[model samples]
Target: MGVTDEVLTEEHKIEIRRYFYNHQNADGGWGLHIEGHSVMFCTVLTYVSLRLLGESSADGDGAMRNARSWIIDRGGATFIPSWGKFWLSVLGVYEWDGNNPLLPELWLLPYILPIHPGHWNSARDQCAKEDLYFPHTRVHEILSSSLHNVVEPLLKKWPLSKLRDRALTMVMDHIHHEDTSTHYLCLGPLNKVLNMICCWVENPNSKAVKCHLARIKDYLWVAEDGMKMKGYNGTQLWDTAFSVQAIVASNLPNEYGRS
Candidate 1:
């Protein structure tokens, strides 16, 4: 869990944006976890976060599109890192062909199973018990921004009834920070896809943002392969492993370093 604030004032957002611009690695990079190699999640997400804070992606502020290209070239959200793949797969952006076949079989296991997050988080109360009562971990509050009231419900980002009117609104605002600017429409689903739709719909500008959505929707066909992606990149490891495995499985072997 990284820093989770109820709200980041515009001034604070600007200051943080300045920090990312000034403190980014001298190599014109930022690594995963502030220590590891640069990754799609760190590069794209952080760079976008900076931009949302009002940093420019152009040459004058910093070439954030360079980072976006890193993610795009490697493949966008689909090819980010291991966790990225898992989530992308879960979110239906990637196929499970290369995954290690997570033993959700464990869900069927007897109570004695040892490797569960349930077992690992010894310091915390039983997740099952806690969830039974509380059911979710999201921290939300009353919001005053236009994002919470206007954008959230329009996009249908979360279970609206479950959320306070304020919380649902907040979700749209956060997603809007990136979606409104990035021209990204990766996570396709009835509701999430609506966010992209709304961005274009709501853009009162030159109608340019609407075109971005039009382009993304160009590859929206479904199939028996079960909505397989054209070439979405979920996690860095997920994409790399998938490519490597396909090559090896084809019996045309080659040496590639596996992270």
Candidate 2:
């Protein structure tokens, strides 16, 4: 976590690149999930990841070339969904200012408040058409416009800016608490990665960042295709319970089961 290139070992990087290549859609892009159709959201992110791993635009046996073509045909990374944009921005390829304000102050509100983070929708409704699950409502459009045009500018000024700083402190406190409580794995793969990023940003050499790095292997799974992040750390209790029930129903011999 201290340095970008040192995060993954050489072997780890090779397998990660293999996973992307093996899962590429016939159209030379990737899907939002495994075995799904290629979408801008997945395609652009995968392409950027390949580049970060030292693949040129021409690498991957023409796979990278075709991926670029797919993105170009769909208006490049500009149409990638907000999730992809966030990753790209963190990687320094996309402009952070291009994104709508995600007010950290929202985390400061009471849980009982309707404006609390649980229901907060700070970003605009923009996303690649392929990834759009629901159409944007008029109310959402108005809210996005208001935040982008009015609220964001005002928040940059005196008193409101101080509030943002305080809110950030509160957010980091929560993140650290969650990391220590969960032994640095957090809730799931997504939150684990997010929490790790926050820790790295806060202090790359801090104990929290080191603990997060130690727990990373918990999320990795090696399949026939390649290694990939599991949906969560593991469902050990759930899997064990079901497996025991099945073995009992089968009336497996005690010696055979024990063996």
> Against the true structure, whose lDDT is highest?
2
In candidate 1, stretches whose alpha carbon ends up further than 4 angstroms from where it belongs are: 1-6, 33-37, 55-60, 84-105, 113-259
Candidate 2 regions off by >4 Å? 101-212, 230-259
User: Residue 124 of candidate 1: its Cα lDDT?
Assistant: 36
Instruction: Report residue 37 deviation for candidate 1 (angstroms).
Output: 4.5
Please provide, for model 1 over 115-182, each residue's C-alpha lDDT reduced to its tens digit, 9 standing for 90 to 100: 55355434433456645765534442223234556765665655654556576568657767655454
lDDT of 1: 0.55
Task: Please report, as a residue range, the 10-residue window in candidate 2 with the lowest summed lDDT.
Answer: 117-126
lDDT of 1 at 144: 27
Q: Residue 12 in candidate 1 has what lDDT? A: 49
